[model samples]
Target: MAALGWMVLALVFLDEVLAAVAAGVWGSHAGGWPLAVLAPVVVVAVWWAFASPRARWGGPVVRRVVKVLVFGLASVGLWVAGHHGWALALLVFSVVVNGLAQLPSIRGLVAEQERPPAS
Candidate 1:
């Protein structure tokens, strides 16, 4: 489960890096430098907010809620900003893939808490 979480996180980070590069190149050419910077900033901020140690025990509820909220906001932002079509597609894909990837760990954690200890 820990490995899965780390893998998902690594993929998410890679996605962010790719998106940032795409935004920086395309956005700058399109006269949207703010987006080029904002893309990476938002990625870093989301990682810090939800993945930080303070949030370690926040549990599945918090994790899922944060994931949905952040992804939804990011999707909407992409749609509104009207960047590359591929960027929007990639964002949506990452959201769904990451969400699915984390579900097993979240369910396992929940079940572990619910189970009674053996005598």
Candidate 2:
């Protein structure tokens, strides 16, 4: 479960990077240099505010919600950016893998590891 948690974290980062790239590409097509640069900055800011490990938001629920939103939107963004096959693959991978991580047994396993041992 801990390993899965790490995998999920890595996936989250990948999703964010893909999202930033997609946004920048879209911006480049729609506007120009400023928009291209600003798109990634905005995406990163929102991600840091709502999805980062130290996000100033709710608990696990909020984090999960943000994760879904971020990855889902990024999947769409990838499709729009002309990577249809990659987008679908990412969507499927994120859904199935994240779903597994949400299983109660897996969550409990991860939570158990997070606890400090009693003296």
Q: Top TM-score: which candidate number?
A: 2
The CA lDDT at 50 in model 1 is: 73
- What is candidate 2's local distance difference test score? 0.73
lDDT of 2 by residue, 67-115 (tens): 7876777678667778789778878877876676667766676577678
* Cα-based lDDT for every prediction: 0.60, 0.73
Instruction: Report the alpha-carbon TM-score of model 1 versus the true structure.
Output: 0.49
Off by over 4 Å in 2: 1-5, 103-119
TM-score of 2: 0.67
- Cα lDDT of model 1 by residue, 55-111, tens digit: 644465775676556555555555555655865776777776766655867546546
How far in Å is the alpha carbon of 87 misplaced in model 2? 2.1
